[model samples]
Target: MAGNPQGHQEGAAGAARPVGVLALQGDFREHVSVLRGLGAEVVTVRRPEEAAAISGLVIPGGESSVMDKLSRAFGVAEALKRRIAEGMPVYGTCAGLIMLADRIVDGIRGQESLGGLDVAVRRNAFGGQTESFEAELSVPVLGDPPMHAIFIRAPVVAELGPGATALATLDDGTVVAVEQGNLLGTSFHPEMTADYRFHQYFLQKVAGFDNGTARSSRP
Candidate 1:
């Protein structure tokens, strides 16, 4: 199913190019719509075999621990990490960022991550779901209007290595967006915003990967 260009809804096209939404949890539908709006096929990703044909993937915000457990239970965690390591572009939102991080300071007990990106995430560093909010960011990769970001129980990028580029931050200098290699992780939910710029940025990255124009950045 797809969403609006930015909300939770279903897609009308089944034959479009598939972009998998790690449907283990929250905001998966919202992401489906954003990818759909970008003219890609939108669908929920389940087992490892189900991920074979997708060119790109989006890991949506939710309970990171639950998502971790679910992905492992479904036996696709290794496949995901392997595919992304091989150059597939990925975008992670909120809890999704936590999933992509190498070190998680506040994740669920004994939870394992995809470990594809090198960054540290502090879960709920900006507060809880009730404290969720939005802000306008000067995301150059996005465009002129600035990217509108929505954060719900979001994580913050604490420290980055040489491969990471800080894309956006909060007033106090909290790291909220970082690009480590082909992986793009955002502490906010662009899928919940009116702006498709963030979606556009990731789409461009995916396109670059598809065309072999993407520069490798491993740390």
Candidate 2:
């Protein structure tokens, strides 16, 4: 499906905005390519200090447990928490959603997160890798024509707290995408396709725009 080019209303001309992709694991390269294609400078973030330098960050799809281990091992976990608390825009795909979540269901013991979104995500809610599939999603925030979503052993937002807004969902009403303040979480991988609306939305609506524009706190 063709994406709406005008989905982003903040500033189409991507100038100095440098978006970062968490390079610790997963499909970070694909995200980097997409961001660069959108005309924004891209940065590969592997360290906490590096994470602080970018205007926004993308956590790609990968094993949630593995990502958690790596983030803590490399000291990126705490740093990310600090950044998100400061209202830094961050988008997470698949396991990325697991990382941004404040609550996780059936997670490993001692598993920690950056804790931005007030949602409960169940890992592998769509079953194993073999159960992976694609669907056309109607994301109202990005406007018409529906976006193609790629789900690979994806997690699902089983329960959204008072803070999060449901962006897209399955036909059965399973929450697949959510936006909470400057944080965006998707169970599907937007980097896997040609459509760039999701990334653009993050840049324009969350990253470039300040804290005042988004929900300051949950009501």
Candidate 3:
């Protein structure tokens, strides 16, 4: 299947705009590698200022609470919320997906999120780390053969609003991927595997939509 991340294009001098992956936690390094492999400039998003120049952002998987705490401490949570609100293309996986959701189960207590995507998510809905599993999924946005997805302490989307679209799901009914306007999210980590399709798909979305332009809100 052919997948391309949006906004990135080959400049005449082989130049590329930088894309940043929120580095508060999770596999930020792997995401950096994945974006680089796609021939786009990559940067680690540690502070809001560092993220200001990037065309898009990826929120990597990790402890959702910790990410939220550090994001506030580092002043990124507000910036991220603002960026996405202003139209920066964002992608989140697992805990990252949880942060993007409108509501969370918060089994661990006092759970909070950035609440960008209009979806309700249950943390570790299919069980925690010990119950992690893999299955074939149909991601129509990617096309053709089912994509192999691995779920680790992942959240299952319970519901999404009219603006949201289901991009992929498991055979037994688990929302694996979703797109709400320029914001795209997934419960699985694509960087953990050899496939770069998901990342490419997100980049294509960013390039085409964000394009260094700030949108008023999620479309």
Alpha carbon lDDT of each predicted model: 0.77, 0.83, 0.79
lDDT of 1 by residue, 1-98 (tens): 12222221122443333567899888899888877767775668878975655667899999999999999999989888877777777889988889
Arranged by lDDT with the best first, the candidates are 2, 3, 1
User: For every model shown, what is its TM-score relative to the native structure?
Assistant: 0.88, 0.88, 0.88
Clash tally, candidates in order: 5, 0, 11
Better of 1 and 3 by lDDT: 3
- Residue 65, candidate 3: how far off, in angstroms? 0.7
> Which one wins by TM-score: 1 or 2?
2
Tens-digit lDDT track of model 3 for 10-120:
444555557889998887888888888887678899897876666788899988888888888898887788778867778898888998988886546776788778888
For candidate 3, the TM-score is: 0.88
lDDT (C-alpha) at residue 176 in model 3: 78
